[model samples]
Target: MGSLIFFTVSASAPMTVLAGGVVTTYAVTGSIGVPLSFPILGVALALFTVGYAAMTRYVENAGAFYAYIALGLSRAWGVAGSAVAIVAYNTIQIGLYGLFGWAFSGFAAAHWQADLPWWACALGVWAIVGLLGLFNVDLSAKVLGFFLIAEIIAVLLFDIGGFGHPAGGSVSTESLAPGSLFTSGVGGVFAFGIAAFVGFESAAVYSGEVKDPRRTVARATYVAVAITSVLYAVSAWALASASGKDGLAAGPADPFGMIGQWFGTGLSTAANVLFLTSVFAALLSFHMVVSRYTFAAGQEGVLPRFTAATWRRTGSPVAGSLLQSLAGVVTFAIFAMLGRDPLLELFTWLSYVAAVGVLVLMIGTSVSVLGYFARRDSVESVWQRIIAPGLAAIALIAITATVVVNADSILGAEKGSVLTYVLPGIVAAAVVIGLLWGYTIKLTRPSVYAGIGEGGARQAAALAGIEDLLAQDERIPA
Candidate 1:
């Protein structure tokens, strides 16, 4: 349970979210109401988990969204969901390299007077992540746990300092007002707020690896959501309290540096160092997630059988890890060679795309939960089966629509830029390809298709079928 929550919350990258995401969101949307979005998003997610956690008791697969959607909806949509998930997870993982490189390079130049290219620093972290992915997953979890704790401590200290020294010698709750989110640029606030919780839903992805899947997954999911929500909301409000909403909108050159003045250079330097670790931890966590998803798809025959290969000694997904490493190398090389702005193009654009992909999956998963329980006659309550998921579906629909409508602001682009269509089109293409591939498999491979979403149940069913066929053949004297 501890490591599960660690891996899940580490995906949110606490230090990075505070230093980069929250600060930029303030500047971009000019909405101090950003603090209000976290709780709102949290409520929707809690409703989502009401059904999601219940569904996990019945299905156990690493490709959680794929399995849930497949079982509840159809095998074809499951494949499609998995395809988009691969794209989303990979983009978020690889995209962090840009931020990692940019932050590390800047820190090196400033602190040590040593110059380094962002790509060079990025590749250094990339190599380390690739190496770690080959080892046991427990090792990766430990690493994430260490970094997550350190970053959270640093963020809490910063928040305390910010509150200790309020802008006008008194605390302000202007940002925490629910009505703040209803104003202009509300979509941008929701978009950025939800993006901060990117890794919370990842708890169920590790269901197959945990000790007690039923309790551990549910508990971890709820705890991760609660931790991130309280931390982000408090930190955002603290920053506003320290800098004031008006000053934050004026856009200080460096929010961290500004807040650092309230304390001293020592804490400021520590925050910068932890910021690098935060990004690396998120990179490793997402790498594990993507690899596991690939592994599950292979086990279920959605992808090539070779992808299911795992190291016997450590239970690490070998082929899947290598695939993710190759993806990271290729993406980094492309951005490096093109001489593009690493922060703006790589991190910002890819993060936005990942956010959109996740929102789409959440919507699908919420509806699939309803579809799943509707077909079952279990002892679960009506809220778990229907009410929660129904309301979740509606909330998610509204949230996703709002985010998509204001994509221009989220991406920091002109209103009619080609990216508004092209970036999202990437996810759209994955969905289409998945649907077509799933249909092809159903037509050509009936045996493999029979176990699409049955998870462990599918293997038992196949073995039983084989025994029955053998018995019938023997009785015929063949």
Candidate 2:
């Protein structure tokens, strides 16, 4: 459970959230109320978890949302959910390369006088992450745990510095006021704020790998959300108090520059190094997510069977990890060749798409929870079965709507620009294609279609054959 939380929260990238996300959101949206969004999102997600955790006792799979939606609603919707998930998680994973590259490049130039391009730095980290993905998940968890601990320490010290030295020598709670979040820019706050919690739902993505899925998934998820909410809220409030209401609009573009002013040059330099590690940890974590989703899709026949291949000794998804690495390489090359700004264009655009995509999945999963419990006889209470998810679905609907309406602000495009439509259209297009492919399978390959979200049980023969091949090629463990 501790390892799972480490994997997911590292994906949230605490240092990146403080230095990049929180300050940027405040600057972009001009909202001093950014501190309040974390707790608000936490409440919504807690309500969401009531039904989500209940479903985990029954359905255990790597593709958590995809499996639940398929079983509860229809296999067609599950297929569609898988497709959107692939795109969403891929974008979030690959998008971090841009931020990682830019941060690393700046750090190298500053300290070592080594001028490296962002793409080069990004590819180097990509190579490392790709290699790590093929090892046992526990290995990856250990790596994430180390980085996450350092990140937490760095954030806490920075928060202390901010609070210890207020902008006007007195801490202010103006940003924490509930009324501050009700302004015209609230949509931007929710959109950007939710992006900071990107990896919280990923606890269930590791359901099959854990020792105790029932308790681990539920407890890890709730704890991750609570810790993230408090961390983000307090750090954000401290940041605001440091900047003061008047200085927030004009805060430095590089947030650490402000941190340097508060905590001195030594800590700022250390924080910058940790910031790079934070983004790398997030890349690895999200890479694990995308690969597992692809693995689950293959196990269920949503993708080609080769994707289900795993290394016997490590139990790692061999083919899915390679496939995601290939996707990352191709994406990095395209952005590098086109000369896009890593932070502004690559990170901002794709991260927002990921945020929106995950929100869509949550809403679907919440409704699916209700539908799932409705069809079966179970010991779950009425509150768990109906009321909780029902209200969660409603809350998510409103939040997603608000996110969509303020899409222009989040993406930094002019109002009514095609980029807004195009970015989100990626998910929409995935849904349409997924639905069509799912229906075609239902008609033409009914046997395969019947096991669309059943995970490994229905794919035993295919997995055995792959294992035989692996053994022959490399003397893999039986």
Candidate 3:
């Protein structure tokens, strides 16, 4: 179960998002340094993960932020963390909806010469995912696994061709130089690279479903990060090398297109097919993420209790999944009604908003890691406890600031600065609301609030102990 969730979290949606759009943006922004930036960001994130994984051993909860914040700080902080998560996941899922619709429509037009609207494609997928979410998690996992295999094969083929047929003559070391990396400014590279690793930490969110929460979560976290980092580094390097120094600088309209040219028309067609498959995987993964978060928040009493209720047999959040699907449907309808192009207009617009939200959430998580381990008496190193988190916080904050300052360029905005300010502002508002909600809970229901970080059974045990009751109800019934 843990492995399945980890697969869903890291492999599915991210492959498409990173390959289709983010990689091109990274090449443009970071130049040859794009390959190097990924590992560096991975290391920084790994530092935070050390403490994050360690804390998981002590506090087991489906709500990752809820566990971290409650263990490290107060319930108020946990609630705020949860809110950031909700916003981040929701934004990402919705943004992908727009992208999926656009990609599907484009493929249909290219292959079948069909002029079906993008939203039509989006709505169809939305309905399918919603129906699937209401059933078994295993079914969703199977679908994702199939998509993952296809995407990996596609990426590998592209990478092989990249090295096999060198484009623009030969590769250059200048693209990997420190100057080129820092030249485009570290902020942009950091933001783009961080986006590549969005789903890495999601392994913990499946603690409830996993076989061994303690070992599985830790192993999955490290393995997922390691695998993803290696893949990104190799693929990015291959892309940069394939494109060559001049091509890298020239900024081709389609980086993947250049790869196709080197590999021949057949491979290019395969890549396009893979690209669509990648988007489908990403959509499935994002749907799982948002639904789980909704489930976690609801269980914590931050939202309605119904959202917490799971399908007894499948162990899926039926209500939360339905809610997320409904939101996607509504957003699809709105964009279609406005006569917006799903890819160019809606997906591009909302993806930036989601990116910003994720940045804020990552920064918060890094900080929470630092705070959680600050005064520890364990054998943990100071680097993991203080230095790494502190450095990551600084880096993340600087990246966030840069994105805010240059939202126009970062988001590919054509006009109106309102979206630039509005998106970040919305994330801020969500955090504030979460904080207030936490405080309200503290005043009204201190017991439930105090039980935040402790696992469900542990909390029930503590409550039962306080009442001098038996342990029968504390254990999950056989």
Candidate 4:
């Protein structure tokens, strides 16, 4: 069931919409080389997954970052990781809310002549998602699955049509050359690539709820990563080819707009619908991610206990879901009051912030993986422990650095560069707060500290057993 939720949410229509948005970003930044970047990033991320998957077998929890940190580092790190997860997923979710509202409002205004504000649509959708989240998890999964299938089919149709009618002469070899690869620079490609795999970690988070978590989680993680990579590679290639090398470089009015011209009105409408569905799906997926992180934190006593409460019958994290949904409502309300355009302003700004948070968390996870293996002195080969993690850390750091350097261009900032620093700064603050919290708990509650690695409920039980044994030993003293 957890795996189903992961797939439904991750592969939903919103992912496709996100894919289009990501592709557009790449095309603008990476140009004709955008297609190649996906594969390269995919391969590098898979390398990170090597140790990532290896670590999962040893630690299990619904909160992905929290669980990973607990196993490799400390409970403080786990708490901090959950904080980052909440910020990251919520940023993405809220950003998409802006995009969804803006897009749907435009759709309504143009198609139905309705003058309703974008926030009106955004709030309505938020209500629906919140209600759905309150119900059984399976229902959410089913809705996501339905949307995902339709979105995938529509995307495939666009791919076939684009490839069938190449915009330029047959596919060019120049797109594969080194010039194209470095045109956007390694930094640009890394940032864009990271977006594609942001949700891949959802697989690990579902371990507790999945049927055979050990196998299912690992398989799903790898499978989702592979499928997502291929889809990006193919769609990007087709999109670039459809626009032609020169045309692509020149930046057509709408790269995707050309699809409507080539495929005709029927297919164009289908593409738009798919894009909208993709946005919705992304919103749902991120919501699930944020709620689970909150639930995990509560379970571990890192957050308010109320968030840990689950619906007994459904075994769903009801309080956590409502909390996250409430956050979404607040965010929407703020943007609405500011009278900001959801698609152009809110979506662009918050999504970039979320991306930065995720990258920071990834860096932390990579370091923890290396540390865990180093301490264990496990017989696993050096590459898994040393090389892969080392390389991944370097790559992630480099990507983070590049984002910092090009923060203006990436964030679409005017003269002010302050917004560019906000993301990394936010992540750093979270980590520092986590470290402090961890120290406090360690000094005041040694028992909880000892059980941090074991996780919440299990850790408490283990501590009780230890106390019982000690009491018996004292009683029997002679």
Candidate 5:
């Protein structure tokens, strides 16, 4: 369970968020207290987890979102949610390659003077991730743990240094001031803050592999979210102070470059190296989560049986893992050919798309939480079942709306441009494909359709014709 939480927290990639994302927040929102959003989002997430944790006690599938949503809503909605999740997670995982490739190649050049194209570096990473995915997740978990510790140490050191030594002549608390957060472009701050939190929900996804799913998954979920929130909030606060006014002004344009200026070249170089490893950690964490989803989808008969095949010795989702790597390679190749800037074109666009997709998925999950408890009563309290999830759904819906209305600002795309629509369109397409596929199964294979998003006993009934028998018996009584 702790290892699973490590993967979940590592997936958030604190180094990347502090170095790149928070800077963007300052640039866009001019809201220095962008740090405050972390706790706010955390609380919202905690509300979400209330019902989510309760649901984990009942559902038993690696397809976390799909299974929960299916049990709560309907099979078709679960399939649709799964399709969107695959796209969202896949895009974000592949998008990180953009940063990793560019950073690694640049690192080699700066140190060893080994000049290489980004694609070459990316292909090397792809091979490594593909191989790791074949082994037990515990091995990769260890790797993440090492990287995660190093990452935490570095960020904390940076924060402590910033707070101890004033940036200019004096450190200012204006960034933490409440009024600062509501400034001009705060919407972008909220948007990116939510994106930074995308990975904290993964503990529930690893339930089957966890030793005591009931208590472990619930405990891990709470711990992961709490850790992530503090990490982001504290780091952002220190960064704003370390930067001073002059530095803050330039953040919108290049936070990475500005950090180098504040810390001198040596620390800057170290940050660059750490940034590459941070991205690598994020990539591996993403692979594990997505493979589990794919494994569940395939096992539930929504996808090919091949994807359900776990590794013989390790029980890892081998087929799904390799497929995710292959998809990443193809995505990298396409972007490299276009001559796009890895940070701007590759990272920004797809990440925004992913963040938006995640927001949509969470809304679905919140609804599922409410429905699950309402339709099927359990011993859980009403606050856990209804109140918390209701608040979460309302909050998530607002964020999604904000993103849609302010797409141009968050993404910096030209007003009414094709790029602006691309992120939202991918999610829509996934839903369309899922709906078509789900309905097709419904028409052609009613028995399999009965269990489209089910698992464990519910799925057994769907597969063994128990539902059909129950229906017949109901009619006979009349």
Candidate 6:
């Protein structure tokens, strides 16, 4: 649970937001409500978790969104959801490679005066991540935990520095006001705030590797959410307080710049350093998530079984890890050959897809939660199994709609750009294909189809042609 919480928090990449997202949201919305939305979105996720955490108890595979969707919706939807999830996870993970390549190269160029290409930096970390991905998940978790603590400390220290010396010589409560979120660009605020919470849901993906998954998953998930929420809000609030009225307008253009100018060179340097590690942390977090999704999909016979096979000693998904690593190499090469701007093209497109994809996954999971318990009454109260998830589903649906309506604003694209329509269209198509794929499974393979969300146990049994044994009484009646 501790390690999972670390991975979850690292995935949030608090410093990255403080340095970029918070200021960007402030700049876009022209409203200080960006900080407030953290808590609002956190609450929505909390309600969503009420059902999500419960569903984890019964889901067979720790496929995270895929398992839940398969069990709650249908096996086909699970497969489709798995496709969308793999795309989404890869989308974000790939984008991070772009960001990582760009940031690291830029850093080396500026400080060390090394004229290296961004792709080189990208492939370098790709090697590190790919190598690490092949090992035990616990190792990754420990590294993430260290990065999480260091980054958090860096942000907190900066916050203290900001509070110590206000940007405009006086603190302002305008940002903390509730009405501020209802202002001009609240939808954009909702859109971006939700994006920051992307990898928090992925803790459940590690269920198969964790101890006492039911309790561990729940504990890590809730704590990850709570800590991510508070850290973002507090850090943003402090930064806003330091920036005051004037700096608020200038904040977005150069967030770290404002910090350096306000705080000092030393802390600013630290923030910059932490900024790189935070993004790296995010990269690894997403890498683990993407690989796990691929691993689970492979296990379900949706993909080649070899890809989902685990390393006996480390308990890591070796095949999926290698495949993801190979994909990263090919992608980085494509970007390099094309000579494209990593951040503007690769990161921009992929990040948008990932952010929206996670929202879509949650919407599916919310409904799946309701479906999971409704068909059976052997569980807890109606509130937990039914009403809570139902409310969550509705809330997520609304959130998804808000984001879609405000997509152009959020992506900073022209009102009806081809890019704008295409990104979302991809996910919608994936869902449709997934639904059909599932229905086909129902027709062709009854046994595997029947084991869709039973924790992969039934599916494994079915694949071994022992599904009948799974249902047979094992009692040695004497």
**Which candidate tops lDDT?**
2
Model 6 residue 96 lDDT?
77
Please provide, for model 6 over 1-478, each residue's C-alpha lDDT reduced to its tens digit, 9 standing for 90 to 100: 8878877787778887776567666765567767788988888898888778777667655546877888787778888888788888887788778877877887787678999899999999998888788884434556666766778888888777667767677766777788977764666677668767887876776777877776788788889999999989887788778777667776354445556776677766777888888877677767887787777677776777787788887889888888888887897789889987776567655666776788888888989888878788755677778887888888878877776676665556777787668887878888888778878878987665666655666556655777567767353111
TM-score of each: 0.88, 0.90, 0.82, 0.83, 0.86, 0.86
C-alpha lDDT score of every prediction, in listed order: 0.80, 0.82, 0.67, 0.67, 0.76, 0.75
Cα lDDT tens digits, model 1, 74-129, are: 88898899998999989988888998998899899989999999999999998899
TM-score of candidate 6 against the unseen true structure: 0.86
Write candidate 3's Cα lDDT for 1-478 as tens digits.
4464446344535457445455545533534576677677767666666666555555566346656776677778778877877777776778777877867787788678999788888888887777777774433566666766666666777667667766666655565677766653454455556656777777766666767766676677766776677777677767776766666567433545655677666766676776766666667667887787787667666676778778878878888888888888887788899897665456655665666777776677677777777656755577657776778778768767876675555455533477667867877888899899989988997766765555555344442354344235454321
Model 5, span 207-295: residue lDDT tens = 77777776687778788899989988888888777787667776453334444566777776777777777877678878887887788
Model 1 misplacement above 4 A: 1-7, 136-143, 168-172, 178-180, 205-216, 250-255, 309-315, 456-478
**Candidate 4: tens digits of C-alpha lDDT, residues 1-478:** 4454447235424334334454545433534566676677666666676667667666745447666776677767866777777887888888878878877776677568999798999998898878777773433566766667766676677677668777655755565566776643444455555655677776665566656755676566666666777877677667766667666656422433555777776766666666777777677767776777777666666666688778877877899889889889898899899987565457766766676778888787888889888788665578767788778878777767876566555455643477656755776787788778877777887655555545455434432455455334433221
Model 1 TM-score relative to the real fold: 0.88
Clashing pairs in 2: none
Could you tally the backbone clashes for each prediction? 0, 0, 1, 4, 0, 3
Clashing pairs in 3: 13-282
Pairs that collide in candidate 6 are: 60-455, 61-455, 76-438
Question: Which consecutive 10 residues in model 6 have the weakest lDDT in total?
Answer: 469-478
Model 3 Cα shift for residue 308 (angstroms): 2.4
Off by over 4 Å in 5: 1-7, 23-33, 134-142, 177-184, 205-216, 251-272, 309-318, 456-478
Candidate with better TM-score, 1 vs 6: 1
RMSD of each: 4.0, 4.8, 4.6, 4.6, 4.4, 3.9
Q: Report the Cα lDDT for residue 235, model 2.
A: 94
Q: Sum up the clashes in candidate 5.
A: 0
Candidate 1 yields a Cα-based lDDT of 0.80
Estimate, for each residue in 1-478, the C-alpha lDDT of model 2 and write its tens digit.
8877776677678898987778767776778899999999998998898888778778857447888888888988889899989998899888889889988999999889999999999999999999889983433556667777888998998788889978898999889888887676777788778778887776776777878776787788888899999999999998888888888888434656766887788878988988987787678878887888888888877898889889887899989999999999998889999998887678777878888888888998999998899999998889889998999999999999888887777677887899878988888898899889989889987767777777656566455555345335432222
